[model samples]
Target chain A: MAIRYPNGRSYVGREPNKKPNRQKELTYSNRGMTLEEDLNETNLYYLEKAIAVIHKKPTPVQIVQVDYPKRSAAVIKEAYFKQASTTDYNGVYRGRYIDFEAKETKNKTSFPLSNFHAHQIEHMRQVLKQDGIAFVILRFSLTDEIYLLDALHLLYFYNQKDETRKSIRKSDIEKIGHSIKIGYHPRIDYLHIVDAVYFSDKL
Target chain B: MAIRYPNGRSYVGREPNKKPNRQKELTYSNRGMTLEEDLNETNLYYLEKAIAVIHKKPTPVQIVQVDYPKRSAAVIKEAYFKQASTTDYNGVYRGRYIDFEAKETKNKTSFPLSNFHAHQIEHMRQVLKQDGIAFVILRFSLTDEIYLLDALHLLYFYNQKDETRKSIRKSDIEKIGHSIKIGYHPRIDYLHIVDAVYFSDKL
Candidate 1:
């Protein structure tokens, strides 16, 4: 099957020529789920375990028209998805304000800057300015690898976009980002990495 | 005009028995707008001024049906509002995680406990436990009075429901809550009250 993004990109679950690793795949359940779903499940697990209070903000929608045939339920006859003014997930985590955006790319070599919007970058900068923990969760679906990249590095690369390549190379991400180890109960344990990066004892 | 709450209460703009006081009425411009709208406007003002990064989370909706006749447009045929798992507004302000819900009541004497839900109270408790600043912005629509009551005080009052009344009285709110002065640009300056209550230098 294929997973579709909000921007209308359809992602096939399998690579074009690579054979499925049956033995390794059996270890992880819900490998078919998208990165967003995996993160939501992780957040729910954290919530239930009283570890964090993160939540994904609902997709912003602009209602153009509505039909009220009866008094009880009004139907939205016309609506469009609006460009979000801020990132998706935000909450309080261990006495710190945590804000982040999750994006998945099938490209094995690089994560495109085009995946982010100007407003979202600005919002992340504002969160960082307020001393909140801000970062982006990058998932390379082809390799089934996830990394937590701090917003400061993202802003640095974004500012150099005009003069450099339009994307961050995999090598750069591997050097600067913290790899999130995938787990069974909480699939993407990004918060563990967050603690190491933002709340480490050295700080 | 009638302002309908999510809980199905209707709030009329005018009180029938009271004669309109022209001079006092001219003080407030958007006297007819709902409390939610007023708060939203205030948040925008704060954002533009770069004073705070607060926003009302979008209303969650379960989309049951949709029709996509064209490639560029999608029309929602049926949808229902979902009970939010967290508070309405949340963001980082001055390096602190801020979370709160805004509610209004037409009742002149007290704010009803029924205006809130068990899940919302639970969410607030979790935010507070995590050391995030949590509160409820109460608007007495009939009297045009606004107060910022901390979640600690609210939880105390909520637990004493069996011994006390089912609502928090005006006198009690005035005693425990900080009154928010209305302004032309920001309208309800609730953050000013938040600073006084939670971040006072003397404390």
Candidate 2:
């Protein structure tokens, strides 16, 4: 299986000079719903209900070729991701900067530490320094389980990656990270956790 | 010709009960460098030169599908655009919030007023109300010329759109928009216009 880049064209975080027509390798996906589709629908539901405002950041693409035969629309020919993004989603919720990275794992026992990068961990650290709310949404696709782990917990293991060289056990996630109950409206009820952790303090 | 959607999927700004896996009609695009790429390269150059802190807002996308086969990586299956964004680029420059949009047109006669969206115009209006500097960058790809048009100028014509079904003419852009010179470090020297518009008053 190959990694299917979420974006279109030859995107590699910087200017990519070529058009990659070759289909990249992709592994089998049996999670039923795509991570994006579910989250989008959930956000819409949340927006209608006016619970919170969290949005997935768009991939920074560099458009190289656009053919606009007419004045109505333009199609991209080649583009690349500007650079490795620091985080996936960020927005204002309850007057706090909420940042998060969502990932699904087929493994039933553990989630791999390699799913995250070092720089991403560093970026999360800065957000924490600014008193921002940061967490990672982990899904055990096999068991249909989801957990919201604070960025601090993820950072701890990330820093110890060289020493431990072990994946974060699923049991540890269930014990330490807050479990978010899936709902009909947002699908992932992450704000309940946010309200409990950050807003609760204000009270 | 139809509107060229960047990805193969349909644009889903609003929530849809069900999505069909159908290919959208092909639209023609004049392959050219996007205002984003130039600005990103320019931002990097500026950062390296210690000039300013400007970056394109990451595109917000909703991810729904994920395939984590062996636990090492997760791949996105389906996703959609979150919504119309607020602005293209924003950052701090010389202790001021700088925000603007970047657009390109092959048409040499006039940049169409349709190129600007209603929400974007409203967003800029709000930014200006809050005392943030707001503007748009128009690149005439055919002529390879770019202009930094202030929000005040854009809002003037934007408000007039309902009254006039016509666009702002090239002559008008030339008259009102600030012409930006391309440079090696930052391709588009937009900050120069910022200095002239915002800082010069202090001087």
Best by lDDT: 1
Model 2 chain A lowest lDDT segment of ten: A19-28
Kindly list the per-residue Cα lDDT of model 1 for residues B27-116, writing each as its tens digit: 553356788888899988888887888889987877878788866677676776678888899999888899999998989889999888
The digit string of per-residue lDDT tens for model 2 on B53-112 reads 455676655545545658554444444445565776665565455678888887888888
Q: Which ten residues in a row have the lowest lDDT in candidate 1 chain A?
A: A22-31
What TM-score against the true fold does each predicted structure earn?
0.85, 0.54
Measured by TM-score, how close is model 2 to the native structure?
A: 0.54
lDDT of 1 by residue, A1-203 (tens): 67798979798655753544563565443357888899999999999899999999998877777677766776676676678999999999898899999998989999999999999999999898888899999988877888999999999999888756699999999999999988888989998898888889845
lDDT of 2 at A117: 73
Interface RMSD of each: 1.5, 7.4
